[model samples]
Target: MYGVILKIINRLQRNPKRAATWQYLKFIRLNRETKPLILYPSYFSVFLILGFLMLASSKGLLSKDINEIGDSVAGLSGVLAFLWLIVTVLLQNRDLNLQYNEIKDMRAASESQAQSLESSQIFQTLEYLEVKLENISEYVRQRRNLIIEELENFSRQNRIMYNGNTMLDLVDAMDYFVVNSSDKDALEFELSNIRNDFTYQSYLRIQAIYLNIEEVVVAYEALMINVPENIKPQVTKYINAHKKSLMVDWCDKMLPYTEKLRHALMRAVVKHGIGPEANRHFLKIFAEKDG
Candidate 1:
């Protein structure tokens, strides 16, 4: 019988609702303060019954008429009902308090879950941005190498002494040759012929690459504006680290070559008086630098 009772108790404990009810009853019974509150109604009922029996025996009411007995029993029933009302009120109050605490805990857990989801979304966005930045960096690197190779090949094919010399050096040589010659028209004609042989397509490619880099930088800045303020510091730190790496690639790998090209173009415009049509593509870039 004891083993069967233990099994029943274990089963009840395994059930959530039963376990909670059992725990509450155990708490009321064991707690010093709550023990009296829960047991007082039972204690009062016991004392009232004992006192009524003693009074009936002294007055010989148990052997009196049935009408007298019924009146006494009805009076005891009313008192018991009043006591039950008080007990019911106390139990209801306790149940209400428990429900309020449960609700508070549930709300707290919900808020925590929402915050966790939002944090996850923010990090995922950062990861996506980082990936985009890496792709842009890789593209820049590849274009830089290709541009350099094309410049070297052009220099070699033209038999131009390009060792340790930049595009500006070649421009300077051409400018010197044009300025020193007495036959101005013939010199201009020769310069025009050289320009025709020059790889104009490479110039356009360099300009496109620079524009692409500028656009990417601008788009990234705009995208960052939507990042949440609370996490902006962390996001900025991560993005800035990648930006710094990109800057290094730009400065170390591409800047030198681009600068040489810019100077050469400027010399062509200022010294040689290149027409507006020829300078049209570079006008925006030059204007930005000037500003």
Candidate 2:
């Protein structure tokens, strides 16, 4: 019997489920309230078995008496089985609660990790865009200088005043001439010829600058759209401040000119009826500006 018990104990020690059950038993033993709940069934079973054996030994029972004892034992067994069933249900409920808590904790952890990853990606994208914006700003600065130089050279060759005068000023002068001339039709015809000639000559360089500025604006819009609502105000403020600095730089340390050359070119195109292409460009610029 001792050897059989030892073998059973060894088998239980090797079984993972049995080891877990043993650990659970130890946990229940640590709790004073749970200890009796866990041990009561075993205690009752042992005492009932000892009492039946003693009763059977003390009396030589008749056949009818044995049947009565058996019926009582069967009824007691049913009650005992019901008690064990209740204990089983309670244990299962505790296990389910533990599992539910674990799942909740894991879900919270996963969501936090996902949010952190998204935030990191957003910041990386913003840094990349900032660098791109800076490069575009530098390119625009160089192109603006080149355009000014070319304009000055053209003015010198044509013997026209270039200093302290903008393209808008030239347009105003032409408009004034056309408006005040007694032979209005003739003056208007002469001015139309000048406008067409000037627009054709200046179109390529002016268009290049306009396209670069459009790229900057497109990137700014994309940046705004992709930023999260929680941090949008901070991002917007930073971008606006950066843009102000770039605008100052582009204006060559003077007050910001707001792309006066481009605007003047567009005005000339519309007023002079350059072509379908120029008209389209003018309309697009007008819509974007208004929007």
Whose lDDT is greatest here?
Answer: 1
Q: Give the per-residue lDDT digits (tens) of candidate 2, residues 162-198.
A: 6544344333333332333455453333323334446
Q: Which regions of candidate 2 deviate over 4 angstroms?
A: 1-37, 51-66, 140-213, 219-241, 244-291
Task: List the pairs of residues colliding in candidate 2.
Answer: none
- lDDT against the true structure, per candidate, is 0.61, 0.59
How do all models score by TM-score? 0.42, 0.46
Candidate 1 residue pairs in clash (backbone atoms < 3 Å): none
lDDT of 1 at 241: 76
The RMSD of every model to the true structure, in order and in angstroms, is 14.0, 11.3
Regions of candidate 1 where Cα sits further than 4 Å from its true position: 1-36, 138-291
At residue 278, what lDDT does model 2 achieve? 53
* Best-fitting candidate, scored by TM-score: 2
